[model samples]
Target chain A: MMVYVIKVGGNVIDNPVLLEQFLADFAKVQGKKILIHGGGKIATRIGDKLGITANYVDGRRITDAATIDVVTMVYGGLVNKQIVAKLQAVGCNAIGLTGADANSIPASKRPVKEIDYGFVGDVVAEELNISSVKLLLDAGLTPVFSPLTHDGKGQILNTNADTIASSLAIALSGSYAVRLIYCFEKKGVLRNAADDDSVINLINRDIYQTLLAEGVLTDGILPKLQNAFNAIESGVKEVLIGHADDVRKNTTDAVAGTLIC
Target chain B: MMVYVIKVGGNVIDNPVLLEQFLADFAKVQGKKILIHGGGKIATRIGDKLGITANYVDGRRITDAATIDVVTMVYGGLVNKQIVAKLQAVGCNAIGLTGADANSIPASKRPVKEIDYGFVGDVVAEELNISSVKLLLDAGLTPVFSPLTHDGKGQILNTNADTIASSLAIALSGSYAVRLIYCFEKKGVLRNAADDDSVINLINRDIYQTLLAEGVLTDGILPKLQNAFNAIESGVKEVLIGHADDVRKNTTDAVAGTLIC
Candidate 1:
């Protein structure tokens, strides 16, 4: 069996039109699948309304107590439930989830060094409750996860949506041939970085090394490519980086994204 | 097999001390159980912070668009997930839910009558999706539902927690002998309104009629008793009105509440 563990971020989440198209495409994808969504700028907007300031240091935003609560409401509650309802409307049997629910994804609070990322969680790939997830999948339920994990000590921790997608792919690889899809703003990993048509069709370890040696990969796409390779190394069958609009096409044999083997 | 469908309202949800103790006891209960929780004053508190005004008509609060979003965040996100994490800490595999999640409980928007309750949902007992719920319960997972439903058209609707509890009990009665429990501040139905210890341990239709004739039932108690009898008539094996502290006991053979048969 093939399972599609797809991730969509703020580019789609914050835009109603984009999200509708993305979810419609997502609902059309066949077979066992999972959706992990990121908390968009709506959290920051709500936090500002509630007087909770967003503190950022070294380019990474911190999840303080108040901020975590705001994100929990926005990501875990408002956005996640709304998406689930919308997916249900589109004929997808979507079940919304947080890591705390069914202990599906237990994580540890990030250990403080110089910066304390207050309520952020760092999930260990091996610790995911795959049995619970597999049961839901086997029963024909599509899980839509909000980017929230719990520390088992009764605390909801902020987590990266991308990390959740790749981690779940690696964990579920044993049960199914998993294709980890990362949906972003661009069409795919662009060879020219500016030209949308310059999407790299296929990249194996050899091609990736050549691209790196030629300085063709931009700093922004570098991390995503690295993550894709890591997921491939960890056991995921395939990794696809593509535009949210291209999700349905990317899922098929006629691919539309940068498929890293 | 006996299944406990328990409901706890604002009194239990608002107080951290009471909620913690109640969850601990709830976790100790054996066998299949489901929890339905009402949105507490925390919604109002957060609503006030977010500048969402609460509108009411002749005492019944209305759920406008903004207010619905706030309740969705507070009840579905913050409160529900928090309870899931706490239950996980106590060794309970709890999956938090809304009527929207998996479309487990489909509802219709309340009809516009004398006053329009903007986004409120009224669930038809038989329309409840018992199969999705039973899948979770049969797999050894407890469901914790927030008082939110959907109109099957991508809109989240505020619902009465009590109604949800009774509705689920009636819907699940075919597969399991359901014991519906409502946890409030009181230990049970009081023989004397002023005496906390004057608990009525059991009540049948005759006792209920006698109590109504004697004017022993208060305005609040009357509606609850009516709901209990309605549930009993609909197929629920037993309906227990008890204190949140007595949840574990109420689930046992030696019940600690007013058992309405």
Candidate 2:
């Protein structure tokens, strides 16, 4: 069975029209199962509205109590459903998931003792329940994920979608043909943020880090690249970082964005 | 000083046109506020298309690993942003949130060790941060939330929107005038679900059980009524269960729905 894992970025998620378009394209991927992982952009937006200032320390969202309430409502509630609706509208079988389901992605609190960060979590793949994934894929449903998860304890923590995608890819290591698709605007990861045409085609961990060091990969690309590395190391076959529009282009000759091997 | 906690339902959220209409009415509500809840129907639609059978035990979704992934994308990614964009389009400064940010809602995994119900979570309210709510309200912006939360560990879980709403109402009890406007197809909590005219004017905890016992209320009303009761008892001044059409009406006199005292 062919299983493709797509990691959608916060920026793409912020744009519903673009996301809708991506869902349409996702429906066209024939003979393969699809899985999606999304970030908390919507949660962030609601947090901003509710006077909840989200402080990201060390690339992790520092969630407090009030913020957690809003995040739950937006990420798992509104945004998760909307994507499912879009997929279904165009006739794609989509299933939505969070870290809590099946204990799929075993997570724990970030362990920041001083900040009192309420529900922030990190993914632990080894302890995840991968059987649930096999069951869904066996039945032929596309899995879409939110970045919420829990430690074995009752505490559910906020997780990064990319990290979830990576951990999930590893947890289901030999089960599915996992491909991480980081969809954003600007045609892919450009050498510079301003140029859309300068998409980087392929990179290993070394080149990815080098670009990061050289400041060629900036903004959102940095976290995504790191996730790409993590995913590849975790067992995902190919990590495709490209424009949401270029998802279908078959290319051994390089398409758009950076591809991590 | 006036903060309205509007509980927009999954049904309304499933239909984009209805969602837009809801947003239009929602924009009319003036206050430093937060929108708390999730969209399940939309997720269900996606699940159905994907051939994933969704099982809900006691109104809570039973998620498998793959289902969790699908839900996260749909809720955290699509539905949340669509609402935010709609709000923004209408000039309503709205932001979306998931539980991870600011530890909005401290979540823990459902501790039923024997039952392998994947990804469901419960809230631990004390861990949430309310400072964001204060800031957003101060800035005259509204927060739209999705029901995805974390348990402080590294896992993200799916949570009930009502639970999140109640928790937030209690958390923000000291400050805002928290009123839950549960928008649904029903006119109000009918003395009988079949009779729209027989709306229950006021329901105290004692009388609520009586209504259920008499077969005057059945089906979904039980949980909603109980949730409303919990909210009021927890300090929310009002709980209005009505159709979206009646949202802008004179809520002071219990316009058209069940008024849980």
Relative to the true structure, candidate 2 reaches a TM of: 0.52
DockQ of each: 0.91, 0.04
Encode model 2's per-residue lDDT on B212-253: one tens digit a residue: 678888777777777888888878888878887677662445
- In order of listing, the candidates' clash counts read 0, 118
* lDDT of candidate 1 at residue B174, scale 0 to 100: 85
Q: Alpha carbon lDDT of residue A133, candidate 2?
A: 59
- The DockQ leader among the candidates is 1
* Model 1: share of real contacts kept: 0.89
- Over A1-261, each residue of candidate 2 has an lDDT whose tens digit, in order, gives 546676666677788677777777777876455455465466675567446788876665678875665565567655665565456556665556556544566677777676656677867666777765565566555667777775655344677777777777766657766666766666777876777787787888778768867978777677777777877887887787787787765222345667789
TM-score of each predicted structure versus truth: 0.98, 0.52
